[model samples]
Target: MKRSPMKPGKPLVRTPFKRTSPMPSTGMLSVQSHQRTAPKRKAGLKSKGPVSTPIRRAARGQDCTLRLTVCNFDPDTTVLCHSNYLADGKGMGLKAPDTAAAFGCSACHDVLDGRRPRPADLSLAGLEAAFRAAVSHTHEILRSMGLLDAAPAAIQPTLEHP
Candidate 1:
């Protein structure tokens, strides 16, 4: 029978399980090409050339800068806690471990490598303004479709036509 081995001076090796991303990975969201101006699209199929005007506000939803809380390293595990290079900050150097309101070091890094580790993510409450705006837009779409009686009360102040 085969047996697992332990060295004379070392502890028995425990094979680690595979780890998975804690965050709903946006890994596939990559830059197709760096746009100097931004791609222009036609408003309708019948239009020949691209729309003359710059992208509309709604089309530029991702233009806003957002802060991301990041932990550079887990000293205990010797693992990096970066979500993305830009999101986590470029290059290597230990971070102060600020412990964002929603996450502490250990809990935020439940998973390492391929193991079923804990993964912590920031709450959407931090983006309350954006979320409210999105919901308001969605409500308007629904209202225009006759599915809603009116735009939601939260979005009322920003409602242009309603």
Candidate 2:
């Protein structure tokens, strides 16, 4: 018997197989391409008027005396607030539900919107805590006004802490 020249553990014969051509280049290969496409709308269209209508109606005729400040030190300085402006102006009030839009005073709104520098005494966590409280308050107001159903449970905040 003749010993194979290859290593003792290695196979003596190589398998003959034809290599197939590369796959067709469909643009779908990259995830970005899929994401670039707009989401499909539902078959039957349900018209929910402007998103701000409910929030505005809820706060309408009501005084913006809600204290959003971390410390209720200066009550007189607080001004009427409408929308809680996002730091980045991308989505504005649309990021969160109508409940998230609370009547914050000008001072507090400025701090949140980065129009005015945040006070050294207040931390980001404290500001966020205040915002959540405002959202909850707005939810209650909406319920009272009959804009939102009181029967259903409130939606949880999307922002999570580590």
TM-score of each: 0.19, 0.45
Which clashing pairs does model 2 show?
none
> lDDT values of the candidates?
0.34, 0.58
For candidate 2, the per-residue lDDT at 133 reads 70
- Candidate 1 local lDDT, 1-162, one digit each (tens): 698675688866556863342435576763433335866976654545433222111222221112223433333422212221233333354332211111113323333212333225544343443323433444454356454476336644565785
Candidate 1 clashing pairs? 18-114, 18-115, 19-113, 19-114, 19-115, 110-117, 110-118, 111-117, 111-118
Deviating ranges (above 4 Å) for candidate 1: 1-126, 151-162
Q: How many residue pairs clash in each candidate?
A: 9, 0
Q: Top TM-score: which candidate number?
A: 2
